[model samples]
Each structure stands twice: as C-alpha cells, then as structure tokens.
Target: MKKYILLIFLAAGITMTISCRKYPVDEKGLLITDNTTCYMSSFNLLGSDNQTVLVTIPTFANGLIDTVKGTVTATAKFGTNITKVKPYCSLGANDMLVDPFMGQWTDFTQPKTFTLISGTRKIKKVYTITVTVQQ
Candidate 1:
C-alpha cells in the first residue's frame, strides 16, 4: 500500500537526518561534552597575608562557597582563580573579580558568580563565589 511505503520512506529520512547531525568539537576533533566541575580554587588578600586559602566547590552542583570563612580587614583587596586547564577560563561580572586577576573591594559582603567557558568549545560551567566579612 502507498501508506506503508510512505511510512518506511519517512522513517529512513528521519534516520539519515539524525545521523548527519554534528556536535561542537574541540581543536582535537573530539566532541565537546558537558562539564560541571567549575569551582573556586584559591582566595587571597592582597598586601597582607599573601597566604592563600584553598576553596573547593561542593560536590553538589552550583554549590555555594564560603571563601573568607572569617572576617577580613576593611581595606583588603583579593585575588582568586579556578584551577587552570587549556581552553577553559573563569569570568565574573565585576572586572576586578575576573579569574587570574585581582583588585576587588572587600568593603561589603556579597555573593558573586563566575562562569567557566571553554575557549575552543561551546560549553559552560557556572559557580557561585561568596566571601564572608564582619560588618
């Protein structure tokens, strides 16, 4: 019957179309995959401790980070970054808070978020960065 022939043709067409679909690939020709391991790696106060506190992203996705863990001086500027790997870098809304950079003000306590994006792939990882300080 024509109905049966049309059904078979439709199924073949769908299969061929799906088989030709392509995913974003990296420079190496490997397909890019979703990654959820974005997190803050370290935090430090400028002109002061020079001693850096290591931070971890909780196992839970999009987990909150309590970076200072305690109060810091009013005049503290901070530097921070995520663990480095090729093609991926962290970015923050505030220019000073960008990854691998410094110069953020510590006068008020608030939460900031960083987006981890791949340089050679279309993937994103999001994380929240928070610092606690005394009023």
Candidate 2:
C-alpha cells in the first residue's frame, strides 16, 4: 500500500511540474520563435455612435531559400466601401511594431512598426486584424 501511494505522489508531482512550465520571452516581452512567422491581432476599436469598421492585414514571405522577408498588406471596409490600405511601421514603447492599419506578422530576426489613418469619422467601429506566420 505504501509503495502504491509513493508512486501516486510521484506522478502527481510530475504532472504539476509539467503543467506549470513557462516559456521564455524575449527582451521586448514578446514570445520568440526561430524560423517561424508570428501573428498578432487587436481588439475591435469602437466609435461613439455604433458603426463598425473591419480591418485585416496579411504578411507575406518570399525570398531566397533560407532567407526570410516580410511585407504588410491590409484592407479596410467601412460599412460598405472596401478600401485597400497600407500602414507604415512605427516604433512603439516596447519596440514592437504598432501598425494600426491591420494585423502584424514578424519573424524573430527584427522588430517592426505600423501606423494607419481612418479616412473618416466613425460613430461606431470595429477592426479585425489577422497575422499569419509562414514556415
């Protein structure tokens, strides 16, 4: 009976340790990856009235084998008019890319920034961003 209890205790301890493991973050507090794309989206940005706007940004990778590069592409639709837009990357407080135009995807190689402008005043608005990491 004592041997069985000891084994059960050992298994429980191991399970707890595994479940509580944490990943290491980079200096910027962002998760780090090797040779992989990372995607990040933002919560909807709502306006005063209640009109909703959706924005999406997709990043692409095309280069020589073993070489990786990133490009930002975005589309914004307000109510009904769909507009293709591009946001400029800007430095953020955490050194992360802050592209309001759309979602952002980046590799571990370098940091990026992005900024966007809404053409009109929206009473109610929401933005959806998607980032895809290509391997």
Candidate 3:
C-alpha cells in the first residue's frame, strides 16, 4: 500500500514538472531559438562594378576584419573615390547586420560603425570600418 502511494506521487510530480516548460514563440507562433554568433568573417569595399576597390598593385590590399577588436580597416586604390563606395562582407548563417544598411553607397573617407546582430537573442556586435586612399 505504501509503495503504491509513493509511485502515484512520483508520477504526478514528474508530469507537473514536464508540463511546466515553456518555449518562446514568435508572432506567428514559431519557436524562437538562440543562435548567439554575430561577427563578420570578411569585409571589403566595392566599386560601381561590384568589384573590390582596394589597391593590389605591389601587394594585395584586403580589408582587415579583426574579430577581437571588432574593427575593419582597408586602403582604397589611389584613384578610387571614397565617398561613393560600397561594402561587402561574409557573416554567419544566422547573423546579419542591423545598422548602416548594406548593399548601398556609403562614404568611407571617415570611420563608420556597422552593427551586426544574431537571430532570436539579438546579440549585436559593432564593427568600425576605416578606409584611407593610397598615396
């Protein structure tokens, strides 16, 4: 008799705990998961033709994407106009930049900050891009 009572109480406790779990849902009732990875893998400036505008004469000049410092630095070609250049980058599958909209003309003569974010958790990372014209 005592064993039966203990068994019933244990089953009830298990069911109550199991039914109490709740997962976050989006507006459409879809489950929201955390994917906390928001960083730029590659960063580059492009010209009107969608090609890199950095100098590559004597040596290739690729933009530095410093994940540690969260900064991007590049040197444009000698004749390239920094005021009318575009930027391209590589990000994680679930990471996207939220500020300073991408795929548009941006003046890079001065340092600019671009904020990247991850899905669900909205983890953000700011990257400063500084471009200088090669003399």
Candidate 4:
C-alpha cells in the first residue's frame, strides 16, 4: 500500500507540473494568450538629427513597449535647432494608440502626451514625450 501511495503522489506531481504552464505577457501585464493583444510593438520619432540626437523607447521584460511611461526624449546638438518633431508608432492587432502631437510640425516646443487603446479589452495607456534643445 505504501508503494502504491508513493506512485500516486509522483503521478500527481507530474500532472501539476504539466498543467502549470507560463503564458506570454505584455508590458501592460496582460496575458498574450488567446486574442488579448495590447502593446506598442514599435515607436520612433522621424526627421530628428539621428547623428546628434538620442531617442530611447522604454520596453517591458516581455518585450512589449512600455505605454505608461512611453516617454521619448530627444536632445539636439550644440547650436542645433529642432525645427519639427513627428511621432510614429505601431501597436498590436486591433489595438489603437494615438499621439496628440503626432504629425504636428513644431520646434520641440513642449511636452507631448500619447494614449493607447487596447483592441478588444478597451484598455488605455498613456505616455509623455519631450524634446530638449541643448546649446
């Protein structure tokens, strides 16, 4: 009877291990299993001085871009002026994210805010972007 009980416990442990599988998650902490798609895959600023300016887009451990702190900062070169700033972003399938300063022509005048909407779940994520001119 003891041998049989031991065998049963081993079998149960194997079953539990098999059942506990890890699923993919996005930066928003949303499970990527099924059709739950909510994240920014790509983000960038165009027409900026690529040589002298630095742009950084934060991301999550799961490789999803961080929407909450989706701040992208650009610093101009010495004596260089930032004439215009344009934002380009790519979201998940059916997911929608908008940048209030998108496609707007400016001289990096002020801070910009962005919002992202999840496709089916209707989740919203906000981000702030800023640009600075350094002499």
Candidate 5:
C-alpha cells in the first residue's frame, strides 16, 4: 500500500512540474503591426475640482514607430457644478514629440499652446492631441 501511495504521489508531482513550466519572456516584447488596434483608457483627474478626461489613443501603423492620432474630451465638476474643460499638450517628457512629426488638437476646434500652471490646478484639466508622423 505504501509503495502504491508513493508511486501515485510521484506521478502527481511530475505532472504538476510539467504543467507549471515557465514561459520565456520575449526579448523584444510583443510585436505591433499595421493591423493592430491600440486602445487607451480614460485618465482620472484628482484635485479641488474633480474631472475625467477620456480619449481613444490612436494606433501606429508600425507600433510606436509610425504616426499615431486620437481625440480627447474633458468634463469637470466643482462641488455641484459641472463644466466643460480644455486641456493642452506640450512637447516634452510628460508628452514627448518625436522629430519630423506634428501633433494637433482638433476636438476643441482650436489650436492652443500648452501652458504650465501652478500646483494641481492643471491636473484636472486634460487635453488630447492627434499626432501625425511624416517622412
């Protein structure tokens, strides 16, 4: 009986070990192609004024190498009041721009400059810029 029990335990352990094989991580990560559709979730804003900005981040033709485009719309509320807000994008680290590419804002129907505000005032205000890469 002990021999049979030991054999059963050994079989189970070998099965489990084979099933739990570790998958190797790809060296270059997942591949992105022209047919791939990338989706972006909404950004949450926290401050004296509560706001939520949602946008569909555009996908690139070549995944992070090609041009990308998308739209951004923001809604803000202070206390019991609700209002529409406008956001801007800058050409820096927070929102970096690659060379030879152009990013434009088309949702608000205007071209606005990205401004740095004091404290968290600008935190609740968000905008989206459609990016286009050109040769």
Candidate 6:
C-alpha cells in the first residue's frame, strides 16, 4: 500500500511538471518563454533636431495609448512643422516594424496607422495615431 501511494505521488508530480509552460531563468538571469507582448508602449514625435516636439501634458506621456480602442493621440507644440516630423515609438523588446519605418520624415497632416506584431509573430494589432497641432 505504501509503495502504491509513493508511485501515485510521483506520477502526479510528473504530470504537474509537464503541464506547466513557464520556463525558468537562463544563464543571463532572464526568464525564458515565448514573448507574447503586442502593443505600443510609448509614442513620440521628433523634429529635425531629433528631439520631441510634442507638447507634454504633464511633463511626460508624449502620446496616449488606448488599448481598448487601438488608438494613439498626441498634441504637437504650437508652430511645430507637422508636415515633416518623424515618429518614434517603443514596442515589445523583440518586436519588428518595417515598411513605413520610424525616424524618417513623415507628414502628420493626417492620421497614420501602424501595425504592430508580437515577438512570437502570432498576434498583431493595428493602432491609429492622430496628432493635432496646438494653435
């Protein structure tokens, strides 16, 4: 009876170990797992000097991220040249964005849409960014 009980416990332990998906830390002390983050964490607009040209609402938050509605919004400073401003963004560490790349002169006269893909490349979300120039 004792041997049978021990065997059952071992089987349960093995099942639990196999069922769990979270991996342990690796040599670099970083948790090993398939990254699932897929969103724009931050958004900023820069001018020719490569510095932010958007007016801060409270000294921070270059733009607002509305995850529910998948929208990003910001207000550019008065007299800013929105026609040739460049956009900078912070996304998931391993994520990749191409085709209308950042840091290039882009006209923000109208709203722009950006598609962000997860590091795992299994999830994607599109965010529409609208910048209004302050008068």
lDDT of each: 0.38, 0.33, 0.74, 0.57, 0.32, 0.76
Q: Considering lDDT, which of the candidate structures 2 and 3 is the better prediction for this target?
A: 3
How well is each residue in 31-69 modelled by candidate 2, as lDDT tens digits?
A: 432222222222222223333332432322221111122
- State which candidate, 1 or 3, has the greater TM-score: 3
lDDT of 5 by residue, 19-99 (tens): 997544323342222222232223222222433333232223223212223333333332312223333323212222222
Candidate scoring better on lDDT of 1 and 2? 1
Between candidates 1 and 6, the one scoring higher on lDDT is: 6
Task: List the RMSD of every prediction in angstroms.
Answer: 11.3, 14.4, 6.5, 9.6, 14.8, 7.1
Which candidate model has the greater TM-score, 4 or 6?
6
After superposing candidate 5 on the true structure, give the runs of residues whose Cα lies further than 4 Å from its correct spot. 6-10, 28-38, 44-71, 74-135
Task: Sort the candidates on lDDT, descending order.
Answer: 6, 3, 4, 1, 2, 5
Off by over 4 Å in 2: 33-35, 38-135
For model 6, which pairs clash? none
Output the number of the lDDT-best candidate: 6
How do the residues 1-135 of candidate 3 rate in per-residue lDDT, one tens digit apiece?
999999999999999999987767656575556677777877678888778898631111243667767787778888888899888777764434446677789998789998886656467788887888988
Worst 10 residues of 5 by lDDT: 117-126
The C-alpha stretches of model 3 lying farther than 4 A from their native spots are 1-32, 56-63
In candidate 6, which residue ranges exceed 4 Å CA deviation?
1-33, 57-63, 96-99
lDDT of 3: 0.74
lDDT of model 5 at residue 103? 31
Q: Rank the candidates by TM-score, best first.
A: 3, 6, 4, 2, 1, 5
TM-score of each model, paired residue for residue: 0.31, 0.32, 0.67, 0.48, 0.24, 0.67
lDDT of 4 by residue, 26-128 (tens): 6767554444555666655556544323335433443335545565554544554456655566666643545463555555667766776554445666766
User: What are the per-residue Cα lDDT tens digits for candidate 1 across 1-135?
Assistant: 999999999999999999998767755565554442333443333322333322332222232333333111122223432221111122322111233223443322354444544433343444454443322
